[model samples]
Target: MTDFYTVRVHHRQKGTDYTLKVPDNRYILQTAENQGADLPFACRNGACTSCAVRILSGEVHQPEAMGLSPDLRQQGYALLCVSYARSDLEVETQDEDEVYELQFGRYFGKGKVRFGLPLDED
Candidate 1:
């Protein structure tokens, strides 16, 4: 039998909460979208943090969450696009840029660009 879990998502930007019945065999984001949750996502390949969330409760199995660093994962960050429910779960959607900065800020933090302004060469 496929294990099903209740996954609650707190969408911070929209100030909405979505409750979903997720199965251990499926990724959370896909199920969520199918259920009309209208969540944010980009590059649904687990290589980006556009669908990042912070686990508020319960467990998840996300062996393919390559977008998250181990430290971030240890701190309860998860990429819903590649995560499967392991138990009843609660998560809060994260700002993609914040997660990206946390994940790769060290390597790409040096460049800043202003809109409509030409970047300095050299």
Candidate 2:
């Protein structure tokens, strides 16, 4: 028998909430979208933070979510595009820029730019 879990999502920016019956084997975001929920996503393969969410309760398995660091994941962050519900779950949509910043803000403005092509150096 296939197991199903209740997935509740709070879209903070849109001030909306969605409740979905998600299969344990299925990706949460995709299932929600298939059911007509308007969730944000980009690079659905889990390479970006556009679909990032904060797990308010319960757990998810996101082995393919490469966009998030281990620390972030441990801190309850998840990339919904690649996350599978592991239990009845509650997640809050995060601002894309905010999550991106938390994920990579340390590297911003820290590296020197080599503006010109290496072969065209003056």
Candidate 3:
């Protein structure tokens, strides 16, 4: 088993590729359809190539990278969402969309938004 830290991926598709322990936390592309503290993206199947990015360093495991071309694959590119941490790896994701941090509220509704632009009224 391996421990995974909540890492902060730099830009949408720009970052480092340092080795990480196996069984590390999965990757969630900033462009993934489902966005958390991570980035946001479209089709996660790897067919769209919207989440493709260069790997500055580190390694990754992609069980199902459908459209990753040989040239692109040879260039150290990867789909952030479908890939998993194999052994402590680093990657680049500068083109990814930004996902603002969320405010977790207790069951009793104690938490609230911390910061960002204000909302508009209807």
Candidate 4:
């Protein structure tokens, strides 16, 4: 049988509860997305620590943290993009700051962006 991990998310803002089931090698952020839940995330390859958070409980493995700083990792901080839940876990989102608010969307529903400023041509 395939192994799966369960996670319970306690939203700090909406006061909502979300439960998710993820495969053993899958990241928590993917699991949240699968359940139609939105957690903050960027640079989904761990090249940036933009998706870093505190692991309130459970175990996780980070293969490529792209210099998150050992001090931060020792303090229970984790980069959700490259981290996989070793067991049932709880994590804090980094979107509560006034400067960087997190708004997530379904992976399939992501909008496209066109580079460069608009130019007049007719």
Tell me, by TM-score, which candidate is best. 2
| TM-score for predicted model 2 compared with the true structure | 0.87
In the range 15-117, model 1's lDDT, one tens digit per residue, is 9999999989999999999999989889998887899999999998899987677778889999999999999999999975888877556545455433412
Candidates, ranked, lDDT: 1, 2, 4, 3
Each prediction's TM-score versus the true structure: 0.85, 0.87, 0.53, 0.67
Give, for candidate 3, the lowest lDDT window spanning 10 residues.
Answer: 98-107
Give per-residue CA lDDT, model 2, range 4-46, as digits (tens).
Answer: 9999999999999999999999999999999889999989998
Candidate 2 regions exceeding 4 Å error are 111-122
In angstroms, the error of model 1 at 23 is 0.7
lDDT (0 to 1) per candidate:
0.86, 0.85, 0.49, 0.65
Winner by lDDT between candidate 3 and candidate 2: 2
Pairs in clash, predicted candidate 2: none
Ranking by TM-score: 2, 1, 4, 3
Predicted candidate 4, C-alpha RMSD = 11.6
Query: Stretches of candidate 4 above 4 Å error?
Result: 95-122
Q: Which lDDT tens digits does candidate 4 get at residues 1-44?
A: 55788777766666776778877777777767878987766678
